[model samples]
Target: MNIITLYHGSGGKGTHELIDNIFYKYFYNKILDQQGDSSIINNINGRIAITTDSYVIEPIFFPGGDIGKLSVCGTVNDLAVVGAIPLYLTAGFIIEEGFDVNDLEKIAISMANAAKKAGVKIIAGDTKVVEKGKGDKIYINTAGIGSLRNDVNLGIANIEVGDKIIVSGTLGDHGTAILCKRQDLNFETEIESDCNALNGLIEEILNSKLKIRFMRDITRGGLATVLNEITNHREQGILLDQNCIPVREEVSGVCEILGVDPLYIANEGRVLVVVASEHSEKVLDIIRNNPLGKEAAVIGEVVKDKYGRVLLQTNIRGTRILDMAEAEIIPRIC
Candidate 1:
């Protein structure tokens, strides 16, 4: 009974006990505690943004965060990038039979803490148990709903040739952290995953007078993939300065040893922002003042190109095409 069993997933006493003891205990709220099939929320007005994402990260537990935290942050950041104020979340868990109860509790606690930090409530959730061999130790899916700011208008269509491209901080921290942990590679220095909810940092930028043309969280395919997505449907391309882009020395060392490009590596807490050229400095200052954006830098600018390509100007006197990754360099890294 200490560990999850098949019976816990059945709609019976075991299931009820698991819900009341774990899910409800950590995600207790006026709406969630009601234990209704669907939560009824009121006082919602204006535009609403909803985002859902699933987390199947291997090792579940990493140096800086676990799957639980990742699940909440993944969805919250998605909403934030769209100029939304996250309000509620629903978490779904698929746990393997024989998974440790303590580990499950730890994950639940992490989710609760992350939700609280992002100022969002977990209003509903579901848990299911699968055969040990058929499933990883645990997988998490989270859906978030938020209200959009009326003054905010952000999208790829708003991107122009003179717009500035800004990155919140250093790249490849999360990917490198997971890679090292998964491979059990011990280097001279340690790297921790930058898995965090970016709502607070994003809110500051949204509230300011800076013109935010477009924004996205640097996730699965890293900064390169995100920029490619922005330029995919447009006639403009992105030109990045290699020297201005922030990459930690430790992360650079790891990527160099592994022959991986940090541009294509994953990041959980970083954001890519495109803003008006006139407001670029103000936006950069705002982001740099925030703790999450201390390393924020203007790495690139949009350009009119026949093909919507991404080019990286190296610190040396060479330029290289930073194309979308043909295949996943590191899979299940988010």
Candidate 2:
């Protein structure tokens, strides 16, 4: 039996067998697998936004979303965060041979729905099949390209000390949902995945009367990690009121029981926006009215700080530091 015993990476017969049997079979797409030293790609007009990601989410199916939707939404968000309007995407899949085709089709449909919502096209894709027990039921790798428009320059450097931080909804739902699915943990209220495309939010910001300095979707490392990354570009500190932060009761309860900080949890549908202090209210208002951002709120503000740290303004009216974790608080949940 050609059971992969984790030596697939070894340069031996088993590795070759796995590669030849699985990868080459399903991943047969045009303009790929060529032995050329470099690929000849046609050129277009403006700068291209490129982002790649691999999905290995445990359980594959969860409360609010599955790996398929996450794969698409995650790619679209990556492009949107950089001020690029996503245009095209490519999906590459590695599937276990005995995996259920009906489940795979459901995933594909969910992915298609997500792409439609984001207004991007899956122009090209490849698929491969592996022997059972060799690979997980499925893993998806996505590469996307988008065109960055003129007059839309946004990045961490654009973030100023006085900028306001806006969150597009509640946090910790996605993480808690996956955790519940993983351990069969039950709760009074089911935690749903926040996996959704932020394209509409970005579109509204671009087309509407609001101005944004910078934006990031709170994902893997969560809101605190994202803000910390921005602080690296400038000497900015973030101050947030613990009570002002919008979190669902169920999510908070799960976090409390699990001893996990909700701020460190992942969110797929939510986004963090840094708006210029002058236009903070308008931006927040626009976000709050949008379909994807109805629960939005101004969570914090950038500050001038020697510490260049993130502080939590506790309900007791005291300040405490929030530091990034060296190891992941939750693993394989995204």
lDDT of each: 0.92, 0.79
Clashing residue pairs in all predictions, respectively, total 0, 1
Find the 10 residues in a row with the least total lDDT in model 1: 325-334
**Candidate 1 to truth, TM:** 0.98
Best by lDDT: 1
Candidate 2 residue runs with Cα over 4 Å from true position: 1-44
TM-score of each: 0.98, 0.86
Candidate 2, residue 228: Cα displacement in angstroms equals 1.0
Backbone clash tally for model 1?
0
Residue 286 error for model 1, in Å? 0.6
